[model samples]
Target: MTEPQTTHFDTVLVANRGEIACRIIRTLRERGIRSIAVYSDADRNARHVSLADAAVRLGGPAPADSYLNVRSVLDAAAKSGSQAIHPGYGFLSENQSFAQACADAGIVFIGPSVHALNMMGDKIRSKNHVAGYGVPTIPGINEPGLSNEQLIEAAGGVGYPMLIKPSAGGGGKGMHIVEREEDLAATLETARRVAQRAFGDDTLLIERLINTPRHIEVQVLADNHGAVIHLGERECSLQRRHQKVIEEAPSPLLDDATRARIGEAACAAARSVGYSGAGTVEFLVSDAAPGEFFFMEMNTRLQVEHPVTEMVTGIDLVDWQVRIAAGEALTVEQSGVHLTGHAVEARVYAENPERGFLPTTGTVLRLHEPSGAGIRVDSSLADGLEIASHYDPMLAKVIAWAPTRLEALTRLDRALGETVVLGVHTNTEYLRLLLQDEDVRAGHLDTGLIERRLPTLAFRGADDHLLAAAALFLHERALNASTTAEANAVWARPTGWRLGEARASRYCLGVSATDSVSVGVRGEPGGASVTVGDGSPVAAGLSAGHDGTMSVDYRGITRVYEVALHGAVLHIGADGFQMELRNRSRAEELAEHLLSRDRVPGAVSPDVRSPMPGTVIAVNAASGDAVEAGQTILVVEAMKMEHKLVAEAAGRVTVNVKTGDLVKLDQIVATITPVNTPDKGATE
Candidate 1:
C-alpha cells in the first residue's frame, strides 16, 4: 500500500447523529481537531450539536432527506470548513459512492478506499473475493446467472437447513433460514423484499446453515503499506432479529487453533480487498462436534461492537481510522498485537423488550447512571432531553471490562440495576435478565440464542402497587419537605403532639401498560402501606424511602419508584414507566378501598367511572343531547395517542365537560341523555 498524496484536515464533520456522532466527536476534540456536526430538523437539539465546534442543518426528519443524502452531508462539511468526514456506523457509512464523493472532492473519508468499498459492498463479491484468498465460505456459489431451478436443485445438493440470503445485503435484511421444502418459496419472497429495501437487489444466494453456530468476528486494521493485522475475534452470538445483542471479546467457544485460523482468514479477507483503515471480518462458527467456521462478511466501517475490541486490544479504532486517512502506516505488527481480559457491552436501547423491541420515545426526566471501576458508559444524553422518534432507539452503550467474563457479566448486571432513567422507557432490565440467564452465562452463545430463549426474559419488571405506594410516600415527603427554617417548626410537624392521634390514609392502586393510578394514598414517616385491586385479589403493599425515591412491594411484584413533583404535574418513574398523576377521583376510591379491603370498612363507590385521567378534547353531547349506545361522545388524548370516549347506554347527556378542561379519572365526561331512553338490556 502507498501513502496518499494529501491528508491534512483541521476540522472533521460527523456525518451522523446520536451516540456514534458524540463518540467520534470526542476523539476529534482530543486531537485538537475542530468538529463539525450535521443534524436533521428532528435533531436540532441533539447531543452532537452541543459538542461540536460548528454545526449545519441537514433538513427534514427522514434519513433520505437528512442523514443518507450525500450532497447534504458534503455541503455541511464544506460549509463548516471540514476537510474530513466521519460517517460513523450507519446510514451512508458503507455506501461506496459516498466514500468516492469525499475522495473525488479531495476530502478525507475515514474508511477504506473507493475500490475496496465497491468490492466489499456487494456480499457475493466480498464473499467470492475472500473465498479466492483461501478463506472458507458457507457452502454455496457466488457466481452469477444461476436460475431458480438451479437454486432449488442446489438446495437439495447442499442438504436441508440452508439459508437464502440476498447476495448484496447485510444486517439481517434479505436473509431467511429455511429447513423444509415447503418453506423455500415464502422465505425467498421475504428475502427478496428485504434485499430490495436494503441493498436494492432481490437476487439471492443459498448457503448451508450452521446449526446453533456462534457469531465470531475479527477486528482488522490495515494501512496502504500492504500491512494488515488482526486484533482477535469477538463473540456476538446473542442476537435478535439477526442484529447483535450482547457482544464480547475472546469468544468462549474459541480455542487456540480456531482463533489462529479465524484470525488469519479475517486478515486475508481484508487483504483481498486491499482494505485500509478499521474494518471487521465476520464469521459463523458451529458448535457441532467438528466445530467449523465460515466467512460471513466484512463491515466496511466501524462497528458498534468496537468497544469490546478496544477493551481487549487497548487501541482506539477511531484514531486509527483518522491516522490511516492521514497517510500514517499502522505501527503494530502481527506479533505485537495482544488481546487481554474480557469485555462485555450491552446496547441499552429506548425500546421495550416485552413489546418486541418497539421503539420508545420520551423525555429524560431524571438520569442517574452507574459509576464505578471497570465500567464505561458511552452516552450523549441529559436529563430533560427528549428522546426523538425520528432516529434509532439505541440510547447508549453500557460496557464493562474485567479479568473474567463472569465478572464482566456481574458488573454489567449491577450497572444496569443501579442505572435510573426517567420519562423514556428503556431496556435496562432486559439486559440484566439476559446476563443472568443460565444459557448466556454458560457461554453457549449464538446469533439465535436470545430469540430462542426470550420467553423467560420477557417479564415486565415494574409493579404498580409498589410504584403507587412509593409515589404516595414521595408525595407526603414532598409536601413535608416543602418547608423553610422560618416556617418549618409550625407548618411541617403536623403530628408532633403527644396527646394527638398519628394516622395515615390508604390507597387502592391499579397498574396498566399505559397508566398507573391510586384511588387513595396512606402515608407515614417510616413507610407507606397500600393495596392493589387486580380484579381478583386486593394485595397489601408497603413502600419506604428517605428521599423522594420509594419502593413498594405487593405480592411477588416489587416496583421501584422515583417521584419528582415539578410545578403543576407530579413526575413519577417506576418499572421503567412514567405516569403523570392529575386530579382523579378514582385515586381516592382505590385508596379508600385499599385501606378498607378485608380489614377496614369498604367505601368503594358504586358509581360508573372513567378508566384514566385525560383532557376532554370534545364534548359532543350537551346536557340534553341524546346518544345511541356505544356512540362516540367525547375524545381524550393520553401519552400522545388519542382515545375516544363512547357512550355505554343510550340516553340523554346529563353533563358534558368542556373541551380544554382536565377531566379526572372516573369523572363524568358525559352521561347518557336520559335513563328512560336507555338502550335495551343496557343499564346506567
Candidate 2:
C-alpha cells in the first residue's frame, strides 16, 4: 500500500491528562495543529479537557477504564478526527503495545519506533545492547537466577555496595542502594517486591554502586535517514529518595572532554538501536576516579527534565519529536547545536516533606506561581482543583535559566520565595530553604543530596516572617474597611496623639508565611491614649480618619491595614481573615487537625469518597452483598496507578460499581448499610 501513504499527518490526539495534557495542547496550538484531548469521566471538567480543540470522553475516572486502556485511547483518536497521537510523558507513553497499536491504526505515534522502545524500555535488554555499541556500562548481569551461593560469591567478587533496580522502570519505582554487604539480601528482596507489584516483574540485576555519583544525561536525536546529534548534558544531582528534585543544564561536574565523551557514547547507543525521534542517554558520573561516567540507561521518551535542555540548547525537543516521527531528517549537526546559558529546575510537589514524602490530597484554594526574569512554571493544576491521593503529588516543575550557575540558583531561590499556595500544604518553604543551604549553592551535590540534608531542608513550620505577614495583611485590610482607622495602625497607633479622650486601642490581625494583614478598632476615635495588650486597650488621641484606610509602621516596614471587628469574621478588602477573640471554633479545628496527624496514606473514610480524579478497577463486593468489618471494598486507578478503597466496618454493599466503571471523588460509588442492621452471621 505504498508504505502506508508516507507522511502528511497533523491534528494530534493527547492521550493523557493533568498538567502535561494542558502543556501539550498549548504547544499544539502554537504549531497550528488541532489538539484532541482524551479524558475519563473524572476529568470531564478538568483544565486539560477545556484546553483542547476537541475532547473525547473515555469512560470512568480510573486509569484502566480510560488512559491505560489501549483500546479506549486509540478509539478516542479515531473518533476525534486526530491523525496522530502524542502520549505525553506518562500513562501509555512508554507502553510499547500502545505505540504499536497507533502505528497499526495508521496514526503516527509522536515518539521513537516500537523497536527502540522495546530495546530501551526493557532496561536489561538496553543495557546489554548498549555495551556492544562501545558505551561504557557498569558491570552488571541481566538474568534473574544465580544460585544463592553464586549470588553471594558474585557480590563478593564484584565488590560490595550495589544498586538493585527494575529493568522496565523510571521515576525510581523499584530502585535500591545497598552499601554494606550485610544489607544486600534484604534490600534486594524489598526492591524486587515493589517492582513485582508495580510492574508485574520481580526480576532484578546487580550493578556496582559508585561512591559519589553525579547524574548526567545527554539528549540525542536521530532520524531514519541516519543522522544523529547530541544536545549538551543536564546535571540532575539534587534528589530526594532517588528521585530528581532539582535539575540543571550544562552540568557543573562535566568538563568539555567529559561532555564530548558522554555525548559521543550516547550517539553511538542511538545508532546501535536504530533509534528514531528524541531520546535521552543517562549516565552516572563517578567522583571516585578521574572523570569517569558510566551508562545508566536510555530513556525511550521525552524526559520531565527536558526543559533544562531546552533553556540551555535553545532547541524545541517536542518539535523535533514530531518532525522526526514524520520521517524528516535531522538538519542540525553537532556544531549547529550550541549550549548557551545555565538553567535549573525544581520539582514542586504536594506532600509533607517531614512525613516520609507521602502524597497529600486537598483542594487548592489559592495559587500564586513564581514569575520573574527567567523563571517558568510548567504545571497542570488550577485554583480550586482537588489534588487527589490517586496520582503523583507533584504539582509543577519550576525552571529558571540564567547566565551562570550562581545566577540561576539565585533566580530559582527568588522564584520559590515569591510562590504562594494556600489551602493545600506544599513544600514551597522546604524548597526555599534548600536553595539557601551552603552545600547546594556550592554545587557539592549527589543523588543522596536532599536525603542527607533534609534535617535542614525539609523544615516544617510557619516562622516569624509568615506570622508578621499574616498580621500585617489583616491590619491593612481592616483599615480599608473602616472609615475611622489610618493605614499605619497595625498594633494600634502608639497610645493617644490625636484629638479625643481615652479610646480602645485594640487591633485584630491575620498572619501567615506568605501573607499578612491587620486592622484597627476605632469605636471611640481621635480621643485619649488607647491601651494595647491582649484585648481592647485605651488610646486617647488616636483620630478616626474619615476615609476607610489605616497605615502602620511596624518592624521598619510601613503597611496599610483595614480595621473592622464584627463579632468574628474580619473582612479585609474582600480577603476575610476570621479573627475570633473567643476560642469557640478555631480551637476545635486545631484540635481536630492535631488528632488527624497520625493517619496513614489512603486511609480516608469509606463514605468520604476521593476528592480528586481517578478510576475504579477492583470491586470486592457486589450490590446487596455483605462485607466484613474493615474489608477491602474496591480498588481505584488514577494516573496509571491503583489505590484500594476499604470498608470502615462490616456492611452490606447496596449500590456497588463495576471494575470498568468510572467514579468521581464524592460521587457515591456504592452505598453501605451497617451489617448489624439486617443480616445475621454470613460466612464467606
Candidate 3:
C-alpha cells in the first residue's frame, strides 16, 4: 500500500508533566514546532513549563483538578491555540474517552485511534480481540460486572495462583496475585477500589498466573497507512511492587527465532486494533518455557523506557510519534529495522529505599546528572526544584548505550555512580547496588528478582572518608562565605595543633540526627590536617576544582567529590551515593538523646505521621479505637501510589485528619496511644 503524505501542525500542547513532557518538548523544538505546556499549581515553575514556548495553567496541584480533568486540558489547548495534543505515557495517555474528546474538539491526539484505544485500553476486551487473531494470550475470564461470588467461582476453573487485574488500567495498579481461595475476597475488593480510583473503572479480569515470568514488551509503530513495524523487545523484568524500575532494549532472554516470533506477534496485535503512533505490546514470557510468552496488555502511548529502544534503534520515537500524528507514513519498513548495541535505562525515583520505598518530597538542594559518550539522561530535575508527591516520584531516567551488553552494564553502572540528587532521599544508591548484583549483571532476571534481592540491598552507611570529606566541604564553604579578612585568617590557622587541644576545633557532624561523627581540623586552604572519628590527626589537602568538585587528598588516598552547601546541610556526591550531612554540637546531640530517652515513660506518641505530602485517601482508625502494632491507621495517596500508615506499637488510635485532607510530611493524621505498652526504641 502507498503511504500518505505528511500533514503538519505548528503548535502541539503536551498534556502531561515532568520528564516526559520535557522530552516531547525537546522533540517538538527540534522539528521547529512550538510546544505549549500545561501546568498545575504544583508545577507552576516546573522545568517542563519553563521549557515550552508558552504555557497555560490547568488548575490546582492534585491531578483530578488539573491533568486528568479533560475539560481543563482541552480548554488549555484551545486557549494556547494548540493544533494537537500529545498525552505522554501516564495520566490521560490511554484514556479512550479523552482521545475521543480530542478528536471531537478537532485537536489531533498523538496516539492511536479512539477505536483502537477502546479495544486495547480494556485488558479483557483486548485479550479477547487479539486471541481471535491467534496471538498467544493467557487463559482468563474477561466478562465484566462479576460479583465476588461469581469471581470466586470463576477462579476455580482458572486455577489457584491466579491474578485479578483491572480491565481498564496498566502499571500494575489494581492488580493482585491470589495464591489461595481464602484471600480472594479481600484482595478482590482492594483491587477493585484501587482500580476504580486509579483508572476510574471497577470492572476487572481474572487470569491464570504465570509463575515467575520475564516481562518483555515489543515496541511497535504504525502510520495512518496500513504499515506497522516492531522495534524489537525490551526486558522490563526488574521491578518493585510490579512497577518497572530498570529496563533494557534487545532482551537477553530471546533467541533470534523467538525474538522474531514475538516481534511478529506484536505487529499482528497492533494491526488487529489498527494501532497507530508509538505503542508497546507487553507479554509475560514463561520462565520454564523459554519460547513461550503471552499477551499482557498494550500501552497506546509512548512508554517511559522508550529511550532505551531509541538508543538501540537509533530512532527518535517521540519525533516519529509527532510525525505520525501529523499524518506521515511509516518511513522504515520491517526489512529496514535494525537493532544496534545494547542500552539499559534505570529510573531514578525520589523515594527512601530503606523505608519500604516510600515516596519522598523536598526541594532539589543539588543536582548533578552524569555526562559521557554512552550516558543519556532524560530528566527535568534542577537545583531548587521541588520533588512533589502530587506526581510520579521518578526524578529521571538514566540510560547508557554501548557496543555490547556487558559494556552497557558497565557504562550504566559508572553513569549511576557519577549521578547525584540531594535534598530528597532517592533510589540512586539502591539502583547502583542492583546494577552491581551478580545476577543482574549476568542477565539472570525475572519480575520477582528485586523483591528477592531487596534484603541484601540494604542501605550501606557512609564510611569515615566520606564523613571527613563532607566535614571538610562544609568547612571550606564556611571559609568562602566569610569576609576577606576572616578568610585570610582561616588560611593562617596553625597546622601543628596537638590532639585534644582546645585550639583544635572538635566539630560534631551528623549523618542523621542521631549518628554524629567528631572531626578536628587544623590548618587551611591548600594544606590542612583533619581528624575523623577517634583516629589520630592525618595530614590532608583541600582545594576546590574548576568543575564544582572538591579535590581532597588524605594520607596516601586522593578523591574528588561534587559538594553543595545549603545552610547547615552538606550534600556530598561521593562514591556512588548522595550523602547528606549536618553539623551539630556535642551538647545539642546529647540533649536530643536525653529528651528522647526521658520522654515520659509509657506515654509514647502513637501519632501516625504522613511521611510525604499528600491527600488522605482513607482514615481507618477512629478516636479511642484499639489497634495493634502494624495495623493500618490511615492511607495517604501520593505520587499516584497509596501508602498506608501503620501503628508502630499496639495502641488506642485517635484520628485527626479526615479523608481528602491535604497533609504535609510529619503531619500527624492520627494519634495512637500505646495500651499498656512500654516505649520501645523507634523501628529501624
lDDT of each: 0.74, 0.69, 0.85
Q: lDDT per residue, candidate 2, 1-684, as tens digits?
A: 223223755689998887778777887888888999988776777779888998998888667898888998888898887888989887888888899999899888988888888888877788888988899888876655553345656777567677878877887677887779888777777777777778876667778878878888999998778899999898888877678888899888778987888899999999998888888898988755527888888888888888999888888888777777777778899999999889999887776455445445556555667787888888877866776655566788888999999999989888876565544456666777777789878877788777778765545332322223333433334445555556356444433235665333234332221122223334323232222323343232322332233443333444443333334433222111111121124454455456457545565443525333356667777877887767777877654446666667667776557777767534567666665454467555
TM-score of 3: 0.91
Candidate 2 Cα deviation (angstroms), residue 657: 20
Residues 1-684 of candidate 1: C-alpha lDDT, one tens digit per residue: 444664666999999888899999998988889999998987888888999998999989768899999999988887888888999988889988999899888788889988898888877788888888999998875665566666776677787888788877776655678889988777777777767766777778888888887888899999878899999999988888787878899889988888888899999999998899999998888877325789988999999989989988899999889988888888999898888889999988876565456555667777877779988888867777887655667888889999999999999888877777766667777788789899889887777788777875656433545445544554455446657775455335432323454333333223432234443343443343443334323344444554357665555566667765444344566434444443324555566456456442443222224444445566666667777777777776433224566777666666556787765445655655335534788876
Could you give candidate 3's per-residue lDDT for residues 447-534 as a string of tens digits? 9999999987767676767766766766665555565674456334333244464355556787763457888776664666788888
**Cα lDDT of model 3 overall?**
0.85
Model 1, runs deviating above 4 Å? 1-6, 144-150, 289-291, 458-465, 477-510, 513-519, 523-529, 534-561, 564-684
- RMSD per candidate (Å) reads 8.5, 9.4, 4.3
Worst 10 residues of 2 by lDDT: 574-583
Give candidate 3's error at residue 646 in angstroms. Answer: 2.3
Could you tell me the C-alpha RMSD of candidate 3 in Å? 4.3
Write the number of the candidate with greater lDDT, choosing between 1 and 3: 3
